[model samples]
Target: MRRPTHLRLLAACAAVAFACSAFAQQPPIERQMSPEQFKAAGLDKLTPGELVQLNAWLNRTVEEETAKAASEAKRKVVNENRGFITFGSNEPIVGRIAGEFRGFGKGRSYTLENGQVWEQVDEARLAGVRKSNPAVRITPSVMGNVWYLAVEGSNTHAKVRRTK
Candidate 1:
């Protein structure tokens, strides 16, 4: 469901970066404006050195603002995907199951407090146990996309995949 939104955000960031590079070769504000418009704006009176300084300032400002926007976009994406295993993160996802957590069973779905839903995919069970909002640690396999969900304080783990 969220894959489209992530793609769009990534595309928008790429577009912004491309646009910045397109303007990189022509950073002079005077060139972007017509000669008549420049004179009308009273920029014609500025000395050559003053024009160079102005262009430099404009470039710096654009770079700074673009960097800030990119940083903010990245933060939003990371926050929105708190429960899922993101790229470059090797740590396990730690959170409590949302409600009554029965012992793990194949095909059972578990919802986490961080709004992630995971479903058991393999035959791993912990029978005759129940807990309310139990803390869980979902860790990714060292070599594959496989992830395991383990209730805190237990040695048993269930193979799972994110469903939401």
Candidate 2:
């Protein structure tokens, strides 16, 4: 029932995003003209009111572009060479644990083979769990500095915090 509305909202946002990127703006006339050409065209002799309007438009353009750039940069994935994991990013980490996978329990920290450390923060205990070097994945939650760890075969999971 709610899926349709959610999909519609997603489609609308995607359309808006596509339109914004598709409409590449041409350089304003103020920037395209050389100083000599601008002076020759008498644009340099504008009234005070007209000059103010031109400056205002240019300033607004710059501010809007800067804000858009910052917003787009937030969605970028961090490079693997930097730290292999990005804080506050929704990217998932998948690998085997350093030791045997005895399943999730409260107040436990599991070190993955990739040299990342995640400490269980919630009381989710798995029954009948025993494996060696089982694959695991830690996914970031919507909130900052929060994550959930899930083993490869079990539906059980636990809230975890990355210590390293």
Best candidate, TM-score: 1
Candidate 1: segments with Cα more than 4 A from true spot: 1-27, 30-47, 75-86
Residue pairs in clash, model 1: none
Misplaced by over 4 Å in model 2 are 1-88
Instruction: Compose the digit string of candidate 1's lDDT tens values, residues 34-62.
Output: 99999999999999999999989988888
Scored against the true structure, residue 49 in model 1 reaches a CA lDDT of 99
Per-residue error for 105 in candidate 2, Å, reads 1.1
lDDT of 1: 0.82
What lDDT would each prediction earn against the true structure? 0.82, 0.69
